[model samples]
Target: MDVPNKKTVLVIEDEIVLRDLIVKKLEEIGLGTLVADSAQEGEKLIKEKHPNLVLLDIMLPGGMNGFDLLERLKRDPILKSTPVIILTNLSTEDKTATEIGAIDYIIKSNISLDEVALKVKNHLQ
Candidate 1:
């Protein structure tokens, strides 16, 4: 059963440890979460769930990287408005990610789990 008025965040990250930690922190803050290990899975979840926001990672295992997904999302009429935050290790791609339509770029190593959750909360509000 879905909870009424609850905001859901979709996290597209392949790292098991980081993904689990992100989900844990989000849950602790009373937000609903859906996780995907790849850009393909993330796209499917975004289409099906219509999450309020997305925490996307750049280095996915599948053929499509985060940039590809972000490009596709921005191009899609229905999904273009969805907020996406790029969470990855690549600091050099920040400009590219913003240009591609990610609302924010977070370098994974520079931020804490609490900060990530806080950012997500702020975006949802």
Candidate 2:
């Protein structure tokens, strides 16, 4: 049975290596993880799991991108308050991401797995 109080983090990243690494790092600290390779899957998981936070990647394989998902989430009454962190290689989108309701934006190439874990921890607190 799933624990009622267990905190979960959803990672919406298409890169297999990065996604797996992030999952491992968060799991090491006892946080539950849900992963999606595209924005569509991310939306489904968010609706079903109601994760505490989401780490989103801008570039996805599906028709919808991370920005679109973020916009949708912000528009939804229930999910709008959920903290979302934009994790992508695009440094230029940081301002736009914040304008769209992302709590933080981290450049993938600039941060380590440990940093990722730390960011998630901070947000969860």
Candidate 3:
């Protein structure tokens, strides 16, 4: 079934350009984007917006890092169901990411933006 509402994506990337790039790619594929510069902001957006999927970066600079946010989401009954995909350079964190309930984890610098879109589509579809 076609999801009637736009599939919203909350992109949490500390780098402005990278965040914009990811958002643009998602938009190009007809997905809505919510960009956040920090995990704290991203977590707030998740609570308020309940986006369909989250493109979370593991290395956020804020005090509430991505791992912590992921953990909170998993523990919260309201937020635990939202799908998350972690995109980071730290491939070593995959086990932790999955343990925290991320649907998928992709390494940056190895995957292209298009690949990311494909991954999102696979989950959202």
The top-ranked prediction according to lDDT is 2
lDDT head-to-head 1 vs 2, winner = 2
Error of 1 at 36 (Å): 0.4
Give candidate 1's whole-model lDDT.
0.92
- Candidate 2 lDDT, 1-104, residue by residue in tens: 12367789999999999999999999898888889999999999899889999999999996999999999999999999989999989789999999999999
Per-residue lDDT tens digits for candidate 1, residues 19-119, read 99999999888988899999999999999999999999998997999999999999999999999999979789999999999989899999999999988
* TM-score of predicted structure 2: 0.96
Please give the TM-score that candidate 3 achieves against the real structure.
0.94
**How much is the lDDT of residue 49 in candidate 3?**
85
User: Order of all candidates by lDDT, from best down to worst?
Assistant: 2, 1, 3
C-alpha lDDT of candidate 2 relative to the true structure: 0.92
Residue 10, candidate 3: Cα error in Å is: 0.4
For model 2, the run of ten residues with the poorest summed lDDT: 1-10
TM for candidate 1 is 0.96
Which residue segments of model 3 deviate by more than 4 Å?
A: 1-4
- Per-model TM-score, in order, reads 0.96, 0.96, 0.94
